[model samples]
Structures are given as structure tokens and as C-alpha cells.
Target: MLYQLRNAGFTLVELIIVIVLLSIMSIATFSYLGFGAQIFSDVVGRDQLISQSRFAVERLTRELRNSLPGSARVINNNRCLELLPIHASSSYLELPQPGQTNADFVAVPPDNYSQGVNYEGTYLFVYANSEQRIYNSTTQRKVISGVTEQDSTLIFDYNTTPTLFPLQSPAQRYFISTGPVSWCLEATGEIAGQQQLVRITGYPLANSPDLAHGDAQRAVMASDLYNNIEGGQLPFFTIAATLQRANLVEIDLRFARRQGAEPFIIHHEVHIPNVP
Candidate 1:
């Protein structure tokens, strides 16, 4: 048992080998984790973009659907989509058309009508066939001067003295609107190299869409749009109604995280089912 006592520890060569192995393992583990984290980050970014696009599209579609018939029009060279949202609609029992002295009409009260609800400043539209009649002609649009409920029917008086309407709805349907609403895609004034989608409200109804009106209320609906207008690409396209098809609104939006990020494009088609 008289053997020389050896050091009860690893040799220098053994320790060096163990250290090298640990270094390799650590490098590989961190690399894998870093790659997974990058993937997660990318997925999250994409999801957020999708959610924003979905909400904007859905809200725009809802308003278009509830708009007055034949009231959807694209102006500013397809940069803006203008619509007159209907507050209420009803079937009329009598309408004061052209050459009528009395500018009063009787209609069945709308389902949403409530007591003491003022109808002043609300416009009455009947048989609006084209964009011209809806926005340009005064006869086709009349402001409600008074509203009175009597025996389950409502009487609506017009501000116009004679109420010379150019056309009448064959279905006898009347649409009420407060004013025009517009969705416009424009360059962001504050943020450089980015575009913004904005909604214009309270602007005086005009024959053309006003991108900048001093009295209009503007709100940004979405940001980070990358639409290429100079390259013949527009955010909105209006397919006119034909005998074989109804009117269609094509919405093409391209979004990105930033200016140089990958673009996420969304295409939506909204059909106008309500015709004049």
C-alpha cells in the first residue's frame, strides 16, 4: 500500500477539455434561444398590423353599407371615398315633388325615431341616381325644417319653398342624412416618410371632396400606409354599376412597420346593394 499519493483532482489536460466543451455548449444554446426570440418578435409584429387593418376595414365597410343609396362616390382622383351616412329611412305616404306649393310630406315614422329627437339640419334624399344629384342639385336634397308626429305617421317639412325634386324613388323610400363623411389617404404632415388614413367630418357638403377644409373635423384612422400613388396605384377604386353588376368599391391598403419594412397588403371589395 506504499503507493505515491496522487493529486485527487483533474489533470490540466482534462480540465482544458471540459472548459472547451462547456464553451461550445453555451454558444449553441444562446444562438438557438436568440433565433426563437427573433421569430416570436416577427410574429407579434405581424399580428398587430393585421388587427389594425381589420378594424379599419370593418368600420369603413359598415359606414358604406349604411350610407344613402347612390351616395358612394370617389373624388380627388380616387384619393378619397365620400359617403352620406343615413341616419334613418322610411317609406313615404306622400311626397311634395316639383311644382308643389306645399313642401310637406307624410311618412311612416322610422323605427329608430324617438320623441323629442330634433330632425333639423338633416337632409332628405329621394331617388338620387348619380353623384351629381346627391351632391350638386339642391332640389334632390332638402333640409328638414320641421318634424311632427301624428297618429302613427310623421310629417316632414322642407326648407325649400317649392321643393322641386328632379326624381322620385320608385320604391317610395326616403333617406335622411346629416352630412358628408370622407375617408382620405394622405401623406402625414408630422411624420416624414409615412402616410396616414384620415376621416373628415363636419365639412360642408360640396360637389367635390375637400381634403383640407378649415371647418372640417379631421381624425386619423390609421398610419404606416405605403401606397405608391405616383406609380399609378391608388388606395381606392370605384367600379361603376352596370346592368350585369352592382357598384363595387375596391379598397387596397398597404401597411408596414416602418418605411423599409416588409409591406402587408390588404384588398377588400364592398358591394353597394342599395340602389336608387
Candidate 2:
């Protein structure tokens, strides 16, 4: 019996069979490990994209909500938004008219006016290529820029007839000019081939005929302003804006994630006030 066992152990064919089985197992294990690493990397990349998108949206929403309505004007042939805030006497101001570099303007206090008057306004300038900027009315210095471009829109001009107020009640207050403003922006490159789109709409301010209000205020009121003016089945993210008060605006942003093996989306809403 001992001799038979020794012969069985010494068989070269049996040893070769065991070696082949072990090799196959090692290959299979390595392959599985490699696959797992790939999946983990993909997941991390997707998460980073989602986080960046969310952060960009949130920052934009905040800036929009604080935008000043009266000071908001279209620039670059109605491709950008230039905003100026109200200013108090004794403050330094700058105005950027078409074809003009920062023209300086000083605020003079109304004669015989009492003190403690709030004389300041928020200024904003929005443009394509995912650029949103804020400026100080007094210093004429840039406050912020490059908020986020991952997904954004440039709203040009909008149409709406001025709302008429009762003659005996009060003067008609204008919020945002009503009408359709051409909105444009580039979607993410990764999803560019997938036909991604962004939908934008404006909400009329309460009792005001103007279209958008303060960025933050409008954002709050713009929650339900999406009407889908353009018809299509493309994957879309929605943005809405409305004027809440004379010096306040609100903005709403929603990132609609596409289904399938795609990155998740981040949604945001913010209110801004005192923007010119």
C-alpha cells in the first residue's frame, strides 16, 4: 500500500494537471481584481462629476437670486447681462455703456435728505460660456466670476407688456420686462453626443408686469415657472427665475439626470437681493 501511494504521488501527469488548474484559478482571480478596480475608478469619476455639477449650480443660483432687476441690461448684442446696483450719495460708481470702458460716476446725496438711507445696489453681469459676474456699485470692482459652467444658460432679452396699475392706487412698478429671452448654453462634453439640453423660463413678479426680479427672490418664486416653450424629448435640466420684490430676486435650478449608465445630477435653488 505504501509503495502504491508513493507511485501515485510521483506521477508527472497528475502534477501537470494540478499546475494547470492552479494557473487557471490565478488568471481568473487576477481578471476579477482588474475588473473591480476599473469599476471603482468609474464610480469615483462619476461621483466627482456629479459633485462638481452640483456645486456649480448652487453657486449660480445664489448669484442669480441676488441680481438687481432695474440694473440688469443685455450686453454684447443681447448675449450678456450687465447689472448695476443702486448707489448712495458719497459712493463711487461706474457704468459700462456700450463702447465705453468703466465710466466713473459719483453719487450725490439728495439735498436736505436725512441720514441713514440705504444707498447701495447689487450689480451682476451674466454671459455665455458659463460666466456670471458681480460688481460693487461703489467700487466698480469685480466681485465674483467663473461661478460654474458645467451647466448654465445665458438669458438675453425677454418680452412682456408693462403691467398697468390703478391710477388711484399707486404707480406701476416694473419687475422684469416680459417676453421670451433667447437662452443659450453648452452642455457637458461627455454627454454632448447624447443630445443633452437645458430648459429655462421666467416667472412674472407678484403684481408687477416685469419678468424677472431679484435673483434670490425670483428663484423662490420661479419654482413652477417652467412651461417648456420648446418641444423636444431631449434630456433636459430646468432653470427658472422671478422677481420677488423691488430689490430682491429668486432663482431655481434643477439638474435632471439621465437614466442608464450616466452620472447623477445635483439640483439647486437660491435667492439674491439688492442687485442692480
Candidate 3:
């Protein structure tokens, strides 16, 4: 009976073998779990980048599609587009009168406040780091200092008079032109260690209120157009406009993603149906 009971129990060598097998299995399982965790983290990061890019594109597109003619103006020598709301109480449309040598505009008060100039509506004149800002009118404020000295190109395209006139010229000739005007802007510089290109389109809204304060004015119509392009690809985007006798305008926009990052793009377009 004693021999039978001893035989039934596991041998010391058998127990040792079982313990070694369990340890090996545990190590392999932990290694696999670690690998799986890393993969999951990578996938989540990629998804987040994609979602952010999509949201940006959708917002930009909606704004551009609603652009109106004669509602857009270029300030700071065409560095930025001054956009006005379609229907507003204030006289929001103001551009430097053509033919005037001065590069800035004078802020007409009572009808407009010089202090609220930046907020009442002004386009940010951003080049590299310098920002030359203005009011609803092209009135110049203190030049934005601390602009970084970087190699970059800013381009502006406008369908104005054939003659390249000076700023501060007569309003009739520069402000209320007989035809539509289109302006295109592009900037190039290093952002975050990568070379990038930024482009924008300006569409002027026709029937915009004159600088006169007595009459409620509609804001200028314009769009962001394009912002930052990398990797030699032109980024996918679209622009379209319609010109009637009352309205004149143009639109430009695009989408792009940074290099070595997940692919993403943002698009914007502005259209003003009634400008004449």
C-alpha cells in the first residue's frame, strides 16, 4: 500500500519540468502583449491626425463657398485680404485708394472708431513674423515688430485697373471700379523646420456700402484661400466665382499635410452671388 501511494504522486523532476514550461509560456505572452500595445498606440495617433485634418478642410470650404463680390480688399500692399460680413451695420469695406503714393489708409471716425479699427474688422498683415495691421479702412497701425527674417515670398493677384496706381488715390477711380477685381496671395517660408507655401484669394463684393458712416454697410466678402503646402504636391482644393454687372470677385484655396506626418488637407472657397 505504501509503494502504490508513492507511485501515484508526481516525481520531483516532473514538477520541475512543469514549472519551467509555465515560466516560458508567461514570458512569451508578456512579449506579445507589449507588441500589441505599441501597435494600438500608433493606430490611434494616425486616426487622430486624419480627423483633425478633415475638420479643418470642411470649415474652410464652407467659408469660401459663401464669398461675395466687391466684399474683398487687400491691405498692407496686398499682404492680407480685408473681409466684411454680407450684412452688417457698420461700413466695413475700405481699401487703399489707387494712385495714392501712401501705402496706408486714413481711418474716418464718428462713422468708425480708430481703436476698434483692429476688431471692427481688419485683415492681419502677416509676413514671416511682421504684422502690418489696419482698421475697416486701410488706416495703418503700429507696424508689428519682431518679424523673423526668413526667406519667403508673398504674392497678391487682383483684377484692378490695368494701371498700377499709388495708394490714397481718388475713391471713384480706385474704390468703385466698373469691373470685377481678383487678388491672389502666396507666402513661402520655413514653418516648424519645413518649407511651406501659403496662398489666398480676394473677392470684392459689389454694392458694398461706401466709407460713409450714415449708411449701414455690408462687410467685404473674401476667403482664406490656401494655407501652407509641403512635399512638392500642390494639395487638392478648388475655387470658383460668378461675375454679374453688380458684383466682381475671385476665390483661391487648397489643402495640404506636413511631411512625414499622416496625410491631411484643408480646402476653402468663397462665392458672392449678388454684387452688381
Model 1 over residues 1-276: C-alpha lDDT tens digits? Answer: 697977688989999999999999999999999999999998998888788888889999999878886778888877789989989988988887667775668898888999878999888888775687889888778888889988888998776634666677888888889999999888886656578888889888879656577788988888888888778668888776665777788899989885738888889999876666
Error of 3 at 103 (Å): 29
Tell me the whole-model lDDT of each prediction, alpha carbons only: 0.83, 0.32, 0.34
- Which of 1 and 3 is ahead in TM-score? 1
| Best candidate, lDDT | 1
> Worst lDDT window (10 residues) for model 2?
160-169
- Worst 10-residue stretch by lDDT in candidate 3? 125-134
Stretches of candidate 1 off by over 4 Å are: 1-31, 189-193
Model 3 lDDT, residue 184, Cα: 28
- Scored by TM-score, the top model is 1
Clashes of 1: 0
Stronger candidate by lDDT (1 vs 3): 1
Of the candidates numbered 1 and 2, which has the greater lDDT value?
1
Candidate 2 yields a Cα-based lDDT of 0.32
Sort by TM-score, best first: 1, 2, 3
Residue-by-residue lDDT tens digits, candidate 2, 86-122 = 2211211223334554332222332322443322221
Question: How many pairs collide in each candidate, listed in order?
Answer: 0, 38, 33
Candidate 3, TM-score vs. the true structure? 0.35
